[model samples]
Target: MFVQFFYMLRERGVPVTPTSFLRLQKALSLGVIGSIDDFYTAARSILVKSERYFDTYDQVFAHYFRGATILEMEDVELTDIAKALLEEWLKHPQEMAEALGLDEEQLSRYTPEELIRYFLDRLKEQKEAHHGGNRWIGTGGTSPVGHSGDHPGGMRVGGTSRNKSAVKVAMERRYRDYSQEGPLTEIQMSEALKRLRRMIPHGPRDVVNVDKTIYETMRNGGEISIVFDRRLSDRLKVILMIDNGGWSMDPYIGIVQTLFNYARSQFKDLKIYYFHNTLYSSIWLDPQRHLRPEAIEEFTRRDPETRLIIVGDAAMAPYELTGANAAIYVGQKESRTSEERLKFLARTFRHAVWLNPQPESSWGYTWTIGAIWKIFPMFELTLDGLEKAVQHLMKRH
Candidate 1:
């Protein structure tokens, strides 16, 4: 089994070595792994040298084992009663919502910590179903701990999510195959941005000018005179606008997240915002699309020289962008259409580029992709694509 697992990783382009495999075997023999989870963690640590190969490793591991249980049956504390409640709510969601007069405004919000505590407490204490109330472990009410209801900050126990407001999900699989492909790791993305960092330098003369000092010393007859200059602090203000609200972007979320996480730490002045389909009236700070969104004007008002990197497939109906079909944010309409908004963004940010996860070959097949490509320089979201995009941004910088 172990030998098969080793060969599977290599076959899948993971670059697994014999030394690493032997180390994994040694660890297993020494009883370093007690549970399946422990073995997985230990094997990953021993076998995978780079995070770039982690996704391949995970796929190989899953294939070799047929399937690995994330949580053992005995380890889970959920009861059959909870399962029954989920089913009941799913069957009669609308009926329960109407009976309770359950509206989002009536719901009370709870902190994540409070929600967890309350959810666990109610799970243990409550023995019967209670409907349409603020404080119970039942459905269709203002309670911060149940499904088929409204709570701005709550724990979703079970059932289909109405609004994406739940702070934490207890157990569910609403979306399919969300596992990351891990195309771009943090290190790779950060290295690409490092080129941009080299271009922009501002504020504080902290770094010593070594060549200038030596030249000055020679001019002053061997008397040492040091010169100081501004250190290259990352003064490159960047606005990362990502489209994560649709299913098309689900697969690329891993690469997007890697870029976002690295860009957050890489740039001194960086602001991240989320949008759906295309640029509209407003953009959200949270990926869940729950939080109050900021006006598009707020972002455009920033430094015009700020590098704008838009990450999306740009695959949408032409009507969605051309204003033949209205695309509003949070029920509020904008004076400008989506296409107009895209034009305005291009004009506002002097330096902007679009990073499309969709392959460059298939880009021409999508009408919206070509439409947006004309407005902004579009590049693939791979490592090579990122390097090219960075180079384009630097030219404008």
Candidate 2:
């Protein structure tokens, strides 16, 4: 049973090593498997390491072990249970009222679903209100009811007018009003606030401090002196490779922005390349460029001091990392051969660190992640990991 469970976890992408499997077996042998909840607790303790892994484990456990009856039950059945629970409380209305410190009249006024729906509805309404009016188009500060504007055939409000020509005029008027930059609607305002918040720095050290550290390292010819000297001499170039999509966007964006800021202040000779998936045979410095036959040769001749930092979730199509692969998205048209590019990148970089938001355990099923892991040092997207990478780079220098 334990072996089956381990296999199930492996199927679900949890990284269960042979050593871990043995430990789990040992734990299970010592204990009497009493309850389902107890088993779940033991399994989680032995198997799960990261928050991302825990989430996947919960999902897989539910799919594999949750009872059929539990799975089959719909919200209606839950509603029935809620109703029964409510009724039981109603029977002891005086005691319930006293315990809740609520008046009998107030308690009688609402049903279970009614109370739930009331709060849900209130929340929905509040969200809508926060976002401002929902009408997609506007009519020159006037309520969307018909209004005339200066146009050849005059504007028709709301519906299409008798003259098809007038429809264009109406659309022009609507577009004009819609494009105006008034006080942003609730949603726009909220998003703007979020962006502003994201831009604010959180770390103890500012970019100036980072620059100072680099400068100090350069001044001292011990370790970091070599890195700076190589960078200045063009013997080494830092290539910051970032993943710009999916679940990694938020954390990677923050990490990249911070690093970019630091680099801008500290190192002026660095080159950064951004890619979504694995690097193929021919990688262009600028992805928008058409890759020529000589692109790979030209890239190799540069001999840049490459310190590659790959930030991603590392979850992609399995073939993306294994077997024969081509450029992601752009087929053979102007893209590089994927496998060759990745190999070249690995060979070129002096130090390569892969920052993954999905954690190490989640890398089990992802072929691409495992492939990248073999080539680059993989670390969780945490402050400690970032600091460790920085320290490693500093030591390398």
Cα misplacement distance, residue 81 of candidate 2 (Å) = 26
Q: Please report, in order, the local distance difference test score of every candidate based on alpha carbons.
A: 0.67, 0.49
**lDDT tens per residue, model 1, 1-397:** 3898888778777788999899888898898788666776688889988765654565556555555433321212243233334346436645434433554233235332343334434554443344234331111233332132211112323245453322112123322122223245677777777788634456888789999999999999999999898766557888899887645564354467667668877888888888888988778776655676888877666888889999999998788888734784446666777888888899999789999987798898889999999999999998899999999998844
Give a tens-digit lDDT track for model 2, residues 51-131.
Answer: 445544555565556421111212222223433444476577766566455677886786643544443334335434432
Error of 2 at 126 (Å): 9.4
Q: What TM-score fits each model?
A: 0.52, 0.37
Q: Pick the candidate with the highest TM-score.
A: 1
Error of 1 at 330 (Å): 7.0
Cα lDDT, model 2, residue 356: 76
Which residues of candidate 1, in runs, are more than 4 Å off? 1-182, 198-206, 210-224, 328-330
**Which residues of candidate 2, in runs, are more than 4 Å off?**
1-236, 245-251, 284-297, 333-337, 394-397
